[model samples]
Target: MRRDLASNIADVPAIAPAVQSAAADGAAIDTKGFSSLAFLVNTGAIVGSGDFGVKLQESDSSGSGFTDVAADQVDTTAPATLTATSSYKLGYRGNKRFVRLALAKTGGTSIALGAIAVLGHPDHAPVA
Candidate 1:
């Protein structure tokens, strides 16, 4: 197997153990030292019927504010019956110093989600 290096530009203290149950903005993640972000989602439990969405967001003032990046949103394929082994991935290009994942759950009885955000560092420094 091929090996690759990973970086956490968001600087989160730890990976989010549980995803938001309702529609809400998540904690800000610092992306100062990286150029890209990858969001990995693992659903451990899901019940009832409802759709779920995860979107990429950005902030310019650290964690004080954030705005959704509509083009980078990801949605669950099976809203009615989410499988425990289901996984999803979203990618974002480096644009701001801070970034985050926004969660939106609708009409679901119960669901448990785990997410880990990873940042990718450029192989070479920017030339200007």
Candidate 2:
């Protein structure tokens, strides 16, 4: 059995952890060498009341031209309306080569939130 997960999977910084009040558009992640992806959204000490909607955007190219991924391609539908200090895991089953996180903060104070994209099922082991 292989126990070295660090060498077998690749990770990309989807969003930087920080206290933000406005909507955030996370960095784009390329999914070319991977087949599976899971997104982790973390929040700490929300100050106001509003739905911090979370959604996935995709594009053939990582630089520009992005659109919202189909709802069916994502695992969760109601995880968008989050307003507390918690963490959520979202799975992406879409076929898009590039994906990113778009956070919509509606009428909320500065919320500390961050996100990461965990790549799995790489085409080759020991992802680099």
Candidate 3:
């Protein structure tokens, strides 16, 4: 995890619940969190299970909200195999501090996410 003092100071008291969702082939996930900061997505798969891909999006509005941030197509051809983890850092250069983070499965028949972690501080410390 990296650090940015300016953004960290702005993220304090602004950290909200991180969200997650999955799709069979074209499903979508949605949730809210602090804006203009970076976030990481930790994902993996189970033994004998199928592989999956993820698509990330964020929004400043509540209703009809969300804009595409990053999208990844994961190949889970071999279960029980150690697949490389997927990660993304979101950065926005606007004043809007409130935004929603959404994840959607763009590919694969079945997929699962271990956890969605948000790091960095709205002050000076990093999220642990």
Compare the candidates by TM-score and give the number of the best one. 2
Give the runs in model 1 whose Cα sits over 4 Å from its true position: 1-15, 72-84, 122-128
Candidate 3 to truth, TM: 0.41
- 2 or 3, greater by lDDT: 2
Across residues 1-128, which tens digit of lDDT does each residue of candidate 1 receive?
A: 11334322333421365644666665676766666667776676666654566677877876576877656343333333345658776676647777777767666765677677766664443311
Evaluate residue 85 in candidate 3 and report its C-alpha lDDT on the 0 to 100 scale. Answer: 52
Model 2: lDDT of residue 87: 87
Query: Model 1: how far is 32 from its true place, Å?
Result: 0.7
Single out the weakest 10-residue window by summed lDDT for candidate 3.
24-33
TM-scores for every predicted model: 0.70, 0.90, 0.41
Ranking by TM-score: 2, 1, 3
Where does the lowest 10-residue lDDT sum fall in candidate 2?
Answer: 76-85
Residue 104's C-alpha lDDT in candidate 1? 72
What would the per-residue lDDT of candidate 3 be over residues 1-128, giving only the tens digit for each residue?
Answer: 35555334332222122222343111122223333343333444423343444333444554545555543322212233224454444443333333333444443444344433233333333432
How high is the CA lDDT of each candidate model? 0.60, 0.83, 0.36
What is the Å distance of residue 114 in model 3 from its true position?
Answer: 3.9
